[model samples]
Target: LIAYGWHTMVTGQNVVLYSRLHLVCSRPRVLRGILWMIIANWFISNVPTTVFVFGASSANPGPFNRPYYVWERLQLCLYFVQELIISGLYVYEVTGMLKPDFHATPPPQKERRGSVLSALGTGKRWKSRKVLRHLIYVNIFIVILDISLLIMEFIGYYEVQVLYKAFVYSTKLKLEFRILNQLTDIATSRMRSS
Candidate 1:
């Protein structure tokens, strides 16, 4: 039951992560690759972990113990890498967003430059960059949380590690609201500008 619960929670977190990534990134290839990665990891990690977890608790657990011991670490490592890849995509796309030179619109020749456009654009860009920076900070903090959980697991703190994992993912989900509003604002501004 715990395994089932954990699986459902972590899987939802990955889905949320992918949805957020889809917002800022437009390339179909990148998005598809990430979706496939999520599905693949879901099968590759969760199935075996579930099997090993149940088996290890059975009455005659000798055979399953060694496998479970190795599998627990492998599963966590897989999740860590999966998250890093998703976060890496965000950082890449966000970095490109911060570079607005190519996307900048030319000022009208008839009118004075940057009167209304410059003021609005400058303020929006500043806020956007600040939001992007916060996004990066959130990612870093998440990575740090994952690292701490990984360390606890490796050091044989299985009991605490499981509870900590739930906390970390919940915290990550909470932070997404900050990015959500900022992203919506950016999209609305872009639409209006166009």
Candidate 2:
């Protein structure tokens, strides 16, 4: 199904990001937490939808046929909360990396930003910060779309909800791919320059 494909794409990107973060980030625990959250969210949100979509064709409908409106709402709520946590973890990691070491002595007046290390460090940090900002914006947009979908579903808009869900997931997958591409490009350029 479309949702399954989207889930797989998102999961693949997240796995790649997780590995990259493990290499570059100071906090492994945070990265692990984010990975776990992503796995959990995928299972909680996507698995049931997949089952329902596939199982609907069977002659004897399983328990999935039961209307679990409350379950759907709960899943959405958990998805939103986990996304907030994941985004917060990303921001935390980026900010932590960007924090200058206060214990180190200041650079000499003559050897300040002119040094290659300083220049590259500042440039990389700026790029990372820009990426972080983009991530935050993307997360906000996703949250907004999720809320809209939830509201529509609650209002008994089942007719359009299915189409909306597919569209939103596809759009989200595309945005995620864009972010991952930009990140990899940044990393590759930095590596080549270094």
TM-score of each prediction: 0.88, 0.63
Task: Indicate the worst ten consecutive residues by lDDT in candidate 2.
Answer: 97-106
Mind giving the per-residue lDDT tens digits that candidate 1 earns over 16-110? 88998898899999999999999999999999989988988899889999999898898889989999999898888877866783456656665
Error of 2 at 20 (Å): 6.9
| Candidate models: Cα lDDT each | 0.84, 0.64
Q: Over all chains combined, what TM-score does candidate 1 have? A: 0.88
lDDT of 2: 0.64
Q: How badly does each model clash, as a count of residue pairs?
A: 0, 0
Please give the lDDT score at residue 165 for candidate 2.
69
Alpha carbon lDDT of residue 81, candidate 1? 96
lDDT of 2 by residue, 68-124 (tens): 445556665676576556555655664564344223345576666578766665666
Model 2, runs deviating above 4 Å: 1-26, 40-66, 99-129, 189-194
- The list of candidate 1 runs beyond 4 A from truth reads 101-116
